[model samples]
Target: MVAKQYVPATGDIVWLTFSLQAGRKQAGRRPAIVLSPQSYNEKTGLALFCPITSKVKGYPFKVILPPSSRVTGAILSDHVRNLDWRVRRARFEMKAPRQSVAEVRAKIAVLLGSGMSSG
Candidate 1:
């Protein structure tokens, strides 16, 4: 039997390893929000994620997810990262609320100096 490959969907919260030390970078195995769409992940084998930290610092760039999302962490929109699932040990936890994901995307767009209309 062949091992199944992991492909996370947009707004899906997943736990992944972010090992290797880096100054001020989020490390260790923690829950992260998947920002890439399913099609993109399937084609590229890469998943875009905004790492979540349970420590909420009240930064404007961070969006706090409600407990309903099964996570009580602040989504660091400024810390969006893309990693190969095959190496990162990404595992699906739960799909976050669409509103929460939209909030993160809006923050990320602003960080990138782009506008995301709330339509």
Candidate 2:
């Protein structure tokens, strides 16, 4: 009998990839930074939103990070910028999968460090 290795629950940790999309004339733009989720719903693949004030609108963008394979920080950031600054939208599909706990943690640390340095 072979024993299967246990995979950590999706709620453990995940990364929300983001991207920025400009006008119709400028499509396929590069993504920005990634957001790290503390936990997520394994079955539903739902991630918590990180609150951030928008520079252009002066309102907060509730970014909903989903469980996907190719979601990057840039993609997530872009989506937030496109929102109306109020109300949540339907869950969208992620181009990538979720990152592991370690990967998420590392990315978060890097983001924090960079943020602190910039500030």
Candidate 3:
């Protein structure tokens, strides 16, 4: 039997593979938070994600995710990556609390230094 395929959604913790990266970029398979809507994930076969790290550094841009059944670590908001979430590359784990998701998104916005807005 094969592993089940799941479409990722915001707040979801998942294991996904990143292509070889250079200079502080994330590579290899690791846990990441899905920040994209499920509809977008399905349509594009991609999920915008922030890489999680156990190497907690208390950085201003990193958000610490307290221990939870879903995941436990710091999300590297500065090292966000949009990558493949297809079955072959990603496996859904669990969802973080809505508040945590919101916090993460907010940090990313600040990291970007511009409120992403459209008029």
Best by lDDT: 1
Model 3: how far residue 38 lies from native, Å: 0.2
What digit string (tens of lDDT, one per residue) describes model 1 on residues 1-119? 99976689998899999976668668999999999899998898899998999898858898988866677889998888889876898898998988899999898778777655676
Best by TM-score: 1
The superposed Cα distance between candidate 3 and the true structure at residue 24, in angstroms, equals 2.2
Write down the lDDT of every candidate, Cα atoms only: 0.87, 0.30, 0.80
Q: Which should have the higher TM-score, number 1 or number 3? A: 1
- With a 3 Å backbone cut-off (N, CA, C), the pairs that clash in candidate 3 are none
Pairs clashing within candidate 1: none
Tens-digit lDDT string for candidate 2 (80-101): 2222111222233322334333
lDDT of 3 by residue, 1-119 (tens): 99856789888888888777567656778888888899999999988898888787758877788675568888887777777677437777888777778888888778776956676
The residue-level lDDT of candidate 3 at 100 comes to: 72
Cα lDDT for residue 107, candidate 1: 86
